[model samples]
Target chain A: SQTIHQWPATLVQPVGSPLSLECTVEGTSNPNLYWYRQAAGRGLQLLFYSIGIDQISSEVPQNLSASRPQDRQFILSSKKLLLSDSGFYLCAWGPSGGNYEQYFGPGTRLTVT
Target chain B: AQSVTQLDSHVSVSEGTPVLLRCNYSSSYSPSLFWYVQHPNKGLQLLLKYTSAATLVKGINGFEAEFKKSETSFHLTKPSAHMSDAAEYFCVVSVGGPYNTDKLIFGTGTRLQVFP
Candidate 1:
């Protein structure tokens, strides 16, 4: 069984401060990773997805960037956070066999004040 | 390009009643569709998926969705609603093949409220 772990379930950051959210998958190696954001009660918006260690495709342009340092490790970062950047950030993963169904992590709720 | 539309933003039903949530999609090519459920403050859980294999797909928690190509709709239904079924549901579409690099488009989502 594969499990995804996301850190800092809830975060409070000052506007203009930096941001970093990490996600790691256990029991699954070399899996595809994704980043999504949901604005309270709204639909999820895809932010970025990585196929490999350095192959990343961004769906939306904003204050966030993603990196796949290791096969099972993905990180979402921002140099300067904005008020609009506050939302529920979710990390998801899929297997290399081309399964469309992705398992998601608990998510990080960021409040930019 | 593939896209999905959730017909209802919210649906309320009494416990033990039937549940219905509608979703429609637009795709240039043969698209793969999926349904995901999210509990409050929880991550998304895959309900089911359609890859043209079966017109009807059964998912977890006694939920099922039927795919209608002519209507371009994939509507979810449950025989009986449980209070635990209250959550937000998202309709997703994938443009590529079953095993390829595909982008997923999510609908606005339908929130379900089940009451006793």
Candidate 2:
């Protein structure tokens, strides 16, 4: 069975601090990875998606960025955090196909103060 | 362009009552529709998905959704509502094409409250 894992579970950071959230998937290879943010009362927003290593497509223009270092390892990073950056971050993986159904990780909550 | 609309922002139903959440979608192609449930402070879980295969899709926890191409709607329903069913439900659409890069568009979500 395939499973997704995300780390730091929760984080509190000050403005101007760096951010790093990791996501790794097991039991699958060459899977498409995605990162999304969910704000209170707002719907899920797609931030970045990677088809392969070193390939990333960003949906929204913001301070955050995503990278796919390995086939199943994806990382979300930011050089500096903004107050607006605070939200719940999610990682998901899916097979390469016309079907867009994805499996999600536990997610991480980051609060920028 | 692909988009989805969940008709209700919030719905409250007594336990053991029938549950119905409405959703409508727009897409240029024969879009794939999905229903995802999100508990409070939890990641979204796939409740069901409607690909081209079946018009009626059954999901976990006694939930099902029917894809209506003529009406462009995929509505979710359950025979009976359980207290555990209380959560926010999202309607999603995907128009997967050449690159498989078609983004999944999410609806505003409908909050289902199961009352005792």
Clashing residue pairs in candidate 2 are none
Best by TM-score: 2
Question: For candidate 2, lDDT tens digit of each residue in A6-60?
Answer: 9989999999999999999999888888999998888989999988899998888
Q: Give the distance in Å from residue A63's predicted Cα in candidate 2 to where it truly belongs.
A: 0.3
Across B1-116, the per-residue lDDT of candidate 1 in tens digits comes to 67899999999999999999999999886678999999988899999999889899999999999999999999999999999999999999975533355567899999999999
Q: What is the lDDT of residue B45 in candidate 1?
A: 92
Error in Å for residue A14 of model 1: 0.4
Q: Which candidate is the best by DockQ?
A: 2
**Decoy 2 TM-score against native:** 0.96
True contacts kept of 1: 0.61
In model 2, which regions exceed 4 Å deviation? Answer: none
Q: For each candidate, report what fraction of the true interface contacts it reproduces.
A: 0.61, 0.59
List DockQ for all candidates: 0.63, 0.70
lDDT of 1 by residue, A1-113 (tens): 99999988999999999999999999988888889999976888889888889878888888899999899999999999999999999999988757777889999999999
Model 1 misplacement above 4 A: B97-99
